[model samples]
Target: MIELAQDSGIWTATINRPEKANALTDKMLTELAEIAEEAGQPGGARLLILTGAGKVFSAGADLDAMQGGLATSPVWERLSSAIAALPCLSIAALNGTVAGGAMGMALACDFRVAVAGADVFYPVMKRGFLPQPSDPARLAALIGPARSRLILLVGQRLDAATALDWGLYDRIAQPGALMDAVRDLAADVLAATPQHVAAIKRLIP
Candidate 1:
């Protein structure tokens, strides 16, 4: 399940299927993409935050759905690309570990802050499936090609400390402080006019 909440100029989207580690089904991915598309429109949010309801941000594609062709679905690319193209700032407030295709959305965000003790990895290699199209390039841009290779190709799992050190995560927060850290980052943008936020974000890329 996906839940979206908006306040002031910030929008927070929470992955709510924590019982399954927030594993994403095809429908959930499509809904996220549509929400992102909406956020990029005229008079939309100034900051968008992606997070999860429980400990894990996402376990990636749902296990049962993966066998039904969800793994190679074009929806992953659609969702991540939409997030990357958002006019406002996008942040992945990783509440916990991120794995498999879930890495795409977080990688597309402008910033990522993970909770302490969390891990990050995309084990597509061991899973016998190539990652979503834009994932490798986006990940390589943030953490470097060698490190990206270590995760995607070698299936290495990175703890939060290591992820921050390698630039995979911009900051690490205690679980209780995760949303506070995210809101702190969003404050200035939230105060600015939507146009100003979009213009400044456009200047970055």
Candidate 2:
């Protein structure tokens, strides 16, 4: 499930199923894509902040739904692409662990802020599945080809500090302070004109 809120030009989307480690379902992914589409429409929020409700950011796709094969679903691609194409700046507030396809979702954001002890990994290979088509390029764009290889090929599980150092996360906050850090960044972004921010976001790779 997902919850979306808007206040003073900032839009926040929270993944609400903490009991399942916020593992994504088809409906949740669809909602994310829909929210992303709405964010680009007229009079939409100026900034978008994506976060998870509890200690796990997302465990990625739900295994039960993958019985037919993961390739049958296009929601992940749609959601990530929609997020990247938004006119306004977007941030992924990584409150906790991020793994598998969730890494692709986080990489789609313009910036990311993770809690100090959060961990990141991409285990597609280990699971005998290839990475999503958009994932490798996006990951490479954020952390460079070498590091991306280590993550995608070597199956490295990076801690928050290493991820920050590799440019995967723009900032790190202490536990229980992730939202505070996000709000501070949101405030700084709000100081700029929406048009200016949108223009700058478009120029980023």
Give the candidate number with the greatest TM-score: 1
Q: List clash counts for every candidate, in order.
A: 0, 0
lDDT digits (tens) for residues 168-196 of candidate 2 = 99999876788788878777678988788
- Which window of 10 residues has the lowest lDDT sum in candidate 1? 189-198
Q: Each candidate's lDDT (Cα)?
A: 0.91, 0.87
In model 2, where do residues sit more than 4 Å from their true spots? Answer: none
What is candidate 2's TM-score against the reference?
0.95
Clash-forming residue pairs, model 1: none
Best by lDDT: 1
* Candidate 1: tens digits of C-alpha lDDT, residues 1-205: 9999998768899999989999999999999999899999987768889999888999999999999999999999999999999989899999999989999999999999889967988889999999999999998888789989999899999999999999989988865899899888877877888788778878885
